[model samples]
Target: MAVRSHSTRVQSFSLSGYHGKPTRGTVTIREFNREQRMRRALEGLGKWWGVALLSVFIPVAHFVLVPSFLLYGMWQLCQRLGTAELATDAHGACPDCGTEQTFELAPRWRAPQPVTCKQCHRGLRLTVPS
Candidate 1:
């Protein structure tokens, strides 16, 4: 097995509410090289395949479980292989409520994404700094 390496950096982002000004924030971005991506894809495949193998022990459920896991593994492998960067963590304050909190971000980093404030339950837009 080849050694897989990845890099991470802190990125600036902004959150805007319908009625409030945009709030500046920071996010942790993880970047994967080709080797890392391949490793991740293979790891995902192996994990799901392991589950599928274990499911074979279950007599009745194996019929559904084995096939489901096998298919899911392939899907995950393709998805991971294509992903180059991911947002792991985000921190910012809600413009509407002025409450500072960590935010949940999607695995694939894309700008102008939609996020909701946990404190105020207000919909906000996350974007990269222009």
Candidate 2:
């Protein structure tokens, strides 16, 4: 057998075929316009800045709002407790003090207990039945 430097094939296929046929050509190379891409990106920086600002602002807004709401909730809780402790039929208030309007707000008494409101000296209504 003799070895030949130039190769030759009998059959040929077009570009779309999956055959291993060979073609002769010098390849062309092209470069990307990177500077143009950079210019385009820089032109859109303002829009990107707005997105960045929103990302930061959203959390900051919630941070401010949540603390304010929490403070308001705590204030309301304090006010409710203060009213429960201080509001009285003692200095001539609360119609149910002497007369039994029904003690719907007081604590439960398991045994015979002497529970009285010091301000009014009137017994509080029992919340739970004995």
Candidate 3:
């Protein structure tokens, strides 16, 4: 008896079907490409639109709605094309400002580096004892 590993299984997928999760790499950390980020920004806008219509009494509504859309567009463009960088999860926080903002990682913006904090505008770096 042999144990099978997850990635080892040869799952056959059809032309019109999905075989496995389309997303790749580790999920704990969030990574984004241009298309993916644009999609997110648009989604944020959509959510704000819904909130505006449904939650009239929402106190945070006024400040949140427009900002969501703006951040989305800005982030979408922030990510440079053909670049690879490491980013925290979408809900990740900035160590400097303490704002829960995910960084837009891009190669041209400087690849081979950890994602930056959007709010604090600081580059996220791994510390090593020297």
The C-alpha stretches of model 1 lying farther than 4 A from their native spots are 1-4
List TM-scores for all candidates, in order. Answer: 0.90, 0.20, 0.29
What lDDT does the true structure give each of the candidates? 0.92, 0.31, 0.41
What does candidate 2 score on TM? 0.20
lDDT of 1 by residue, 74-112 (tens): 999999999899888799999999999999887788898
lDDT of 2 by residue, 1-130 (tens): 4533322222111111122222211111122134433443444444444444455546657566655555554554443333212111211122233322211222211222223434445553222122
User: Alpha carbon lDDT of residue 32, candidate 1?
Assistant: 93
Name the top TM-score candidate: 1
Which tens-of-lDDT digit does each residue in 9-58 have in candidate 3? 11111111022212111112344555655565566556655555554455
Give the winner by TM-score: 1 or 2. 1
Poorest lDDT segment (10 consecutive residues) of candidate 2: 9-18
Model 3: lDDT to the true structure? 0.41
How many residue pairs clash (N, CA or C atoms closer than 3 angstroms) in each of the candidate models, in the order given? 0, 2, 1
